[model samples]
Target: MPEHLRALIVIVILATAVFSLAGKTATQLIPARDFKRRRNLWFALTLLAFLTHSFWLYAAAATFCLLLTRRQEHTPLALFFLLLFVMPPATVQIPGFGLINYLIKLDHPRLLALVILLPAFFTLRRQPGVIRFGRLWPDRLLLAYLLLVALLYLRETTLTDSLRQSLYLLIDVLLPYYVASRGLRQLQDFRDALLAFTLAAMVLALIGLFEYARHWLLYRALLGALDIEWGLMGYLGRGGSLRAVATAGQAIVLGYILAVAIGFYLFLQGVTTSRLQRWLGGLLLAAGLFVPLSRGPWIGAAIMLATFIASGRHALKRLFLLTMAGLLSLPLLMIIPGGQKLLDLLPFIGSVEKENITYRERLIDNSLIVIERNPWLGSVDYRKTPEMQSMIQGQGIVDVVNTYLGVALEVGLVGLMLFTAFFVTILQGIRQALRRLPRHQNEARNLGRALLATLCGVLVIIFTVSSISIIPVVYWSVAGIAVAYVQWVRLQTQPHATLDR
Candidate 1:
C-alpha cells in the first residue's frame, strides 16, 4: 500500500476509536436535546479530508461548518472547538489576486473561524445587547494590546506585510474570542462548547498515547502527502523516549492541550453520574498527559488543581488531602519499574535536561538586558543583540521559551502590561461571578472555578514556552468563556432571567 493510504488507515482506525469511546459520554454530558443526535457522519467527512491529504480540505471543512450553522445543527463555537485540533497546522499559502501580490495563509482552524465564527460575530453585534463588547475591561485591554502590537509590527515591516499580520490577528485571535464570548449564551451552550473541546482534546490525547507507544509521529506522513513544511511537524524526544506530538506539531504543545483538557474534564466529570465512566475518563486524560513528557504542563497541571481546590469550599482540608495523596504516592511511585527515572524527569527536581532550565534562566537574564536597551518600546532588532546571540542553541536559533518575556521583548513593557492586564481582568471577573452565584447553583460555580483554574494554568504554562501553535488560541478561547460566564452569572441575578435554557 502507498504511504498516504497507510496513514489514512491509521487515522481512520484511531478516529473511530476516539468517537466510539467519547461519543456516548459526550451526548450524556450535553444537556441540549438537539445536540444528542448522531455526530458520526460529520466526523467521518472531516476525517476523510483531514487525513487523505486533499487540497480541497479547507473548502470542504468550511462548507460543512457553514451548512451545520445554516441548519442550526451545531453552534459556531461548538464546531470551532470540535475541529480545532483535528487537522495539523500545516498551512497552505494561497496566491493573492488583483492588487494583492502577497500570499494568504490559512489552516483548518482559521478557515473554520472565518467561515462560521466571523459571521456569527457580526450577527452578535446586531443583536439587542445585554452586554456590549467594550463594556468589559478585558475587552478593552485585549483590543488595546492588539492595536499596540499592530503598530509595532507596522513599524518593522512593509504596509502589505503589516496588513497580512493584522488579518491573521483578526481571524486567529479576535474571531475565536468573539464567537466564544457571545455565542455561548445559555448553560447548554457552555456544556456543548466545553464538551466539544474536551472530546477533541480526548482524540488528540489518544493519538498522543499511540504515538508514544509506537515511536512514530502519526501526522508527519499527512504533512508529507500534503507537501506542507510545518516546522514543528518533526519528531521530538526526551530521556530516550518518544514524546508524542500528535496533531499539535510539538510535544510541549500537545502536553499543553492535554493539561487544559484535564482542567475541562474536572468540570465535565461533575455532570456525569456513572462512577466508572468518570474514572475511565480521568485515567485516559492522565495517561494522555503523561505521554508528552512536557514538564511545564506537569507543573501547570499541579497549579491548575491547586487553584481549583483553593477556589472551592473547604479549601484547606481538600488541599491537605491532596498533599497527603501526593506524599503517599511518591513512595509507591518509587517502587514501580522505571519510576525513579520518571520522577527524575520532573521539573525543578529533574536531572534530565537540567540544562534546559539553565537555558531558560540565561534567556530571561539576557532578554532583560535587551529590554533595558529600549525599555519603553522594544527594539525591532532585538534578535540581533549580542546578549541573545550568546544563548543560541545548536539549532542556531535564540529560542524565546518564555511567552511573557517574548512579549516584553517585542512590544516593550506597555504591551506586556496590556497583555497581562487582559487575563488579570478576566480572572477578577470570574472570581466576582463565582461569589455572586448561590450555593445551590453548584454546577455553574464549578464551571467558573474550572475556567479560572484553566486560565491560571495557561498563564503559567506559557511562561515556560512561547505563544506558539494552538497555545494562544486555547488561552484566548478560555478567556472568552470566562467573560461569558461572568455575563451569565449577571443574567441569573437579574429579575425574570432564566439560566437553565
Candidate 2:
C-alpha cells in the first residue's frame, strides 16, 4: 500500500475512534429507563477507550460508570464537580501530533457534556414546583450582562470570532446558571453537589501535598506521554520549593480551588452536628490551603474565615481558638531550626520576589493603556491587536492578570458594570436569604454564609488574576445554587407566590 494511503487510513481510524467515544458518552446522558440494557456495551466501550489511552474517552466513560448509574438527579452536578477535579489544564497536546493539541480545559468538556444533557434539564424545568427564575435582581442583572456580551460580539474582529466568543459566554456563563437553577431544586441536591466538591478537594489536596514534598508534579509525566506540555510546570517559590499545582494547571488556579474548598469545608464544620466529622474535615482543608504556597489564596482563606466567623454562629468560637493557636505558635516556629524555612514558604513572609511583582505591575500598566485606547466596545479581541502583540513581544506578558481590567479590555466599562452587577445581585440574594430564613433553617442559612464567603474570597483572588477559564464556571454554578436556595426559601415563606413558568 502507498504510504500516503496508509496515513489517510490511520487518520480516518483515529477520527472514528474519537467520534465513537464522544457519541457513547453523550448516550449516557440520555434520561432513559433502559440504561441497564446497554450496561454491558457501555462497560466494554469504556474498557476499550482505556486500553487505547484516549484520555477524554476514558474520562467520560469512567465518570458515567461512577456517577451516571446512580440517581439521574445527581449525575449532572456530580459530573460537573468531577470535571473540575480530573480535567487536565488548558492546551494539552494530542498524543501523536505535538502541533495538534487537545484543549482539555474544564469549560470545553463541561460545555459539551451539558449541551448533550440540555434536554434533560429542559424536562426538569417543566416539572411542577421546580424553582425556576424569580424576580431576583441578580437574575435580571445577569440577563442584561449576557445581552451586552451578545451585542459586543457583533463588533468582534471577525464574524467567526464573534460567534465563538458568544457561544463560550452562553455555555460557560449562562448555561451553568440555568442548570444549577433548574436541575438542583431540593436542598439535599445542593448538599450532594457540595459533598462531591469536598471529596474532589480532598483528593486534589493530597496530590498537591505530594507534589510539594517531592518537588515534582506527578501528572507531568502522564501529560508528557500525551504530548501535553505545561509551560508553568517548573514554578518555584521562596527557598526554591516547588509550588503545587495539584490537578489545576497553574498555582493560582489551584490556590483558588483550595480557597473555595476551604469555604465549603468551613460550612460543613459549622453546620454538622457530628463533632468528629466537623474537626476532621476542617483540619484537612486548612492544611490543604497551605500546600499551594500562593499568597493570594492564603489571603482569600483568611478573609473567608473572618466572614464565616462574623456570621455569628456558635462555630465562631472554635475557629477563633484555632486561629489563636496558629498565631501563638508562630514565635515557637521561628525558634526551630527549619522554622524559618517553613515561614519563608508562606507568601509575603520574608523578602518578596521582585520579578513577579515587577511583571504584574507592568502587565497592569499595559492593560490600562489598552483600555484607554479602546474604551468603548473594547478592541473586539485585544490579543489580536498590534499593540497587545507588541506588548507581548516586549514584556513577555501574554494576558492581563487582573480580572476587572481583563473584562474592561474585552467589553469596556459597560461590560465591567454589567459583570459587577451580576455578582452584586447574587450577593444580595444571599444576604436576603440569610435574613429571611427562620432560626430552625440552620442548614440553609449556613449554606448561604458559606457561599457568600466563598464568593468574597474568589473576588479577592480574581482582582489580582484573570477569571477567564473554567474557574468562572465554578463561581457561576455556586451563584446559581445560591439563587436557587433563595428562591426556594421565598416560595416557602410567601404563600401567594407561584413558581415561574
Best by TM-score: 1
Off by over 4 Å in 1: 31-38, 50-52, 57-69, 97-100, 496-501
- Per-residue lDDT value at 353 in model 2: 63
RMSD over all Cα atoms, model 1:
2.6
The C-alpha stretches of model 2 lying farther than 4 A from their native spots are 1-51, 59-71, 91-108, 115-120, 131-135, 228-238, 271-274, 313-329, 345-349, 381-395
Per-residue C-alpha lDDT of model 2 across residues 151-232, encoded as one tens digit per residue: 7777645565566567667767777777776676667666656655665566567667766786766544444443445565
For model 1, the local distance difference test gives 0.82
At residue 469, candidate 2 shows an lDDT of 47
Candidate 1: residue 126 Cα off by (Å): 2.2
Writing each residue's lDDT as its tens digit, candidate 1 over 303-406 gives 89999999999999999999999888777878999888887888887689999999999999999999999897787889999999998898889999999999
- lDDT computed for candidate 2: 0.64
Note the clash tally of each candidate: 0, 0
